[model samples]
Target: MPARVFVALMVTDSGALTAAELAQTLRVSPAAVSGAVRYLTRLHLVIREREPGSRRDIFRVRDEAWQDALANRDALLAQYSGSFAEGVSVVGRETPAGRRLTEAMEFFEFLRKELDGLMDRWRAHRDAPRPDGPPA
Candidate 1:
């Protein structure tokens, strides 16, 4: 599965893996790795690159992978909220179903608003000087 491969790659000392390496590490077929990589690449969760002077492609997680992934969710949240708002309009705002949709819309809008602040806090925490030493 793509999630499994992502976890494996995340724990690896090297941030990148070739298709063959991923297949071997995951104990899956090369086709499985290919499919997973394709999905991950499309999601911007992983990047596909060619090794210099080699035919093999390397899949790598960017240093800001988590941040990038969270950022990408903003668009999805906006879309969902918009859909819910539309549903409220169609169902009549006074109706029970419309009330539920309004609640959902409000919740997602809150998240959309708060996500950036949360990310900013995370960045500050991540970049903060540690008494233990520099981040690994």
Candidate 2:
């Protein structure tokens, strides 16, 4: 359902949809759409906002949604790395559990470090001049 909502929003010209509209488009109940939107919102794949001067909420998928989601993951990676580091410290690095935790910590730390460069490269590719015109 989240996938459906995401695709629906992506293909939508307005890049935004109300819960009732999503339900109608997807042929699902309002409750289903609500659940899906909640999940997507938590994942940073979609944003929810109240319809101005109305009670209905609108969900929008911005041009930078994907980029923002990926960038937000850097903080999660750091958090996981810190957690594993703390676990290792508590268990003693020489213990089997500590060794596992240390490995996990290193992996997350590596990803956090690499994500910066990866995002930069992505921006460069995204911002590179188009064939028909110059860079935006």
Candidate 1: lDDT of 115?
97
- lDDT, candidate 1, equals 0.90
> What number of backbone clashes does candidate 1 have, counting pairs of residues 3 or more apart or in separate chains?
0
Q: For model 1, how does the per-residue alpha-carbon lDDT over 15-131 read when each residue is reduced to its tens digit?
A: 888988999988999889889988988788999889989998888887688889998899999999999999999998889999999999999999999999999999899988899
Q: Show the colliding residue pairs in model 2.
A: none
Q: By lDDT, who's the top model here?
A: 2
Model 2 steric clash total: 0
Instruction: Supply candidate 2's per-residue lDDT for 71.
Output: 93
Candidate 2 global CA lDDT score: 0.92
* Poorest stretch of ten by lDDT in candidate 1: 57-66
Give a tens-digit lDDT track for model 2, residues 16-53: 99999999999999999999989988988899989999
lDDT score of residue 8 within candidate 2: 97
